[model samples]
Target: MTLKPARGLAVLLCVLSPLAFAQADAVRKPDPNTRVPQGVIHHAATGFPDRIVASPLQAGDAGFAVSWRTSPAVDAPMLEIVVAGDSPDMGTPRQVSSRTQALQTENGDARYHHAVIDGLQADTLYAWRVQGDRTWSAWYHTRTAPAAGAPLTLLYFGDTQNQNTSLTTRVIREAMRHAPDARLALYAGDLVSGGDGEDDNEWAEWFEANDPLTTSMVVAPAPGNHEYFEEFEDTPMERRVLGAHWPLQFALPANGVDEAKETTYWFDYQDVRVAVIDGTSALDLGTAEAQARWLDGVLSGNPRRWSIVLTHQPFHSPRAGRDNVLMREHLLPVIKRHGVDLVLQGHDHTYARRGADAAPTPVFVVSVVGAKQYRLSEQARATMRPVGEDTQLFQVLRFDGGRMRYEARTATGRLYDAFELIDEADGKRLVEVTEGRIDERRCDREATLKGRKDRCWE
Candidate 1:
């Protein structure tokens, strides 16, 4: 079941090698004015896969998708899978072919390979590996989604966009320590600070920081404004487009609006239906109506007991001028009509939660996980409850028979907020579950006088 590189790539490489070598020799003098194309320094193929990731393709069908990166030499990428038993070697491995896409980054040209493994038994643990030209990646294990009505837990993160990956990495690792059994890691976009998604260094740092976690835990991501910005000195802000590397990096489900398939998709894990919407497209690309129609169809046909929506921009912005009025005006009603239980969003760089004033149908939340911080606008403060500024946080959600418990914790793992949703015979209701949460973190005169300047809001 081994895959091979396309003949075209081989031919192109062969035709260009001699000229490339000659150019390299001539450039040895290293003229300061001389310019070299990015990703020109190619590395020799090591015959090993790197940056392996597993994601959900179709939860209803128990399908999981795997993707990894390998050197250019390994044209045909392959995946080996087996059901786990008491020992790692207990089951016979099944080898499957994969689809590979070649991409040129600032470092060099590499191929990203993807494969979707279906017919997996729910709640079963599976061991898998990726094959390089010379060797196979070490076997990694992941568990499939459990049956409906079964209790499940997931980790939620906001924007991880930062100048460096250290802060996001630290927070992710800390979160794993608390919910090690979490089935999936859900992100509300802005995975990197790359304005145009062309910075190879930033992408490398992000992937390196989340290597093994991504290999096992399924990642559900939405696209943020940062993910859409293009990095160009002459390109005006309005001319920015979606990052070029986005579609190449992650293999997400394609069940979304035709124009924004990968960025806008949905998957159901057990009884919870999670829909990721592309807020950037809705706001900037004039794709709002199409997405809205697609969303209505998705919601109308959803059979899951509980529905959760994930988007980059909040319906109610936590920052005054940052409000996504377009999203709120167009998509909010659809969400409310469908009785969405929770809406998790990012992009505000602040934390705020607002349960609908009249009902508990959709509890909206906005949070940040990166080092960047923003003040809670006075308007936001007046609207949302328990607002926080200058903070980095992560959320853990657990769903059981008739209850869902959500906990928001600071990077240090201290509880900052808590709530519960109870689905009873009458209807679903939001209940405050914050008994031991730390006092609301805010900047005040006392804190300023005490020299804890970072705690104060701007």
Candidate 2:
């Protein structure tokens, strides 16, 4: 049997004639900027008000693959891509093209609709919206990555799992304010607070917090353990939503195999190659075979100037239940072999920076942006090297043609950590950062619940 490209992989182009174009100029055009107009429209196989999101628009790739949600979802939903080119003046933007097709929707409690807009020109700006039946979303726009060898800037955030709207929002907005020209946003996962098992309100909060940032920020998120449902054994309903939320929210790369296809994949931005992995899948469920194999292949295939690995579990972490020995055993070896420059993770609910344990110091960092806080123990503080607490943080990473620089800061703009990774012929050189003094105060004083710590950081 022959394997087929995933439903959203098709590219449709039309060869237009000169005389036909002249005659078509007589037809009337509709306004594309109109709001979806609040009205009940028949749910297209792929149309609903999902937590609409876009991932990094790689160099030479088409428009972003937008994923959204709808109930009673089918395997396929028709998606429409309307492209609007950039403009120099502040007047109306120019329309480039538009097309529609049937794409697949991964279904469950939160059904997912995904489609890739192909044939986009590199380094050009474009606007698009996904629709089903009569329902259409506000057009969103993203600029494709500049061609290879171009300088780039990307933002990285750890965990946004607690009190998302109130806490994480301030930190995220501040990060964007510091560096407004970032190309892509890399989230280490736990993008939501579904760990408590209450789905409806929790997801809404996550969306509310991220919506403002995502307007222009192309996000790529890995799954943290908090993304998992609390009840594992009983409800099939819960199992259905296990990994469904991710696909419905963000349109990621589909080149990986099996579970890694959309959940764990690699893509190129400018001169850098980024690999996103699922620590939850590999560590919790023991499906490391495909990710490991895919990771190796991705490294072997990469010729980019810089390579980075992203996940939710850190090999060097200060939080409890964070050390995923399985990931270290299977995945870290590949990263080391590939000479990856950076590894970003979150699960500790704090920020930390560590020196390279393996040969080349692959600068490893962990951070959090939620209301949920934890204390770093003596062992954790000692082992993790640089530690932070009772603070919400975000990272701004810049990759120029020559050097890579990163800064960790709090929502109030207090500098926590800062460093530069100098690129060399053999490998990258790490520069130690000295910023704010490590806050050693413990937050868990009075017991809150039976199982976990009580006072966060008073």
| Per-residue lDDT of model 2, residues 182-240, tens digit only | 86888998887664433444555576677756646567788777667545557663342
- Highest TM-score: which candidate? 1
C-alpha lDDT values of all predictions: 0.80, 0.67
Candidate 1: tens digits of C-alpha lDDT, residues 100-207: 888886567888888889888898888888999778899888999999999988989998876435567778887888889888888998887764324656666667
CA deviation > 4 Å runs, candidate 2: 1-50, 57-62, 70-112, 132-135, 195-197, 230-241, 320-322, 358-360, 433-458
RMSD from true fold, candidate 1: 14.3
lDDT of 2 at 190: 84
Error of 1 at 332 (Å): 0.7
Best by lDDT: 1
Task: Report model 1's TM-score to 2 decimal places.
Answer: 0.85
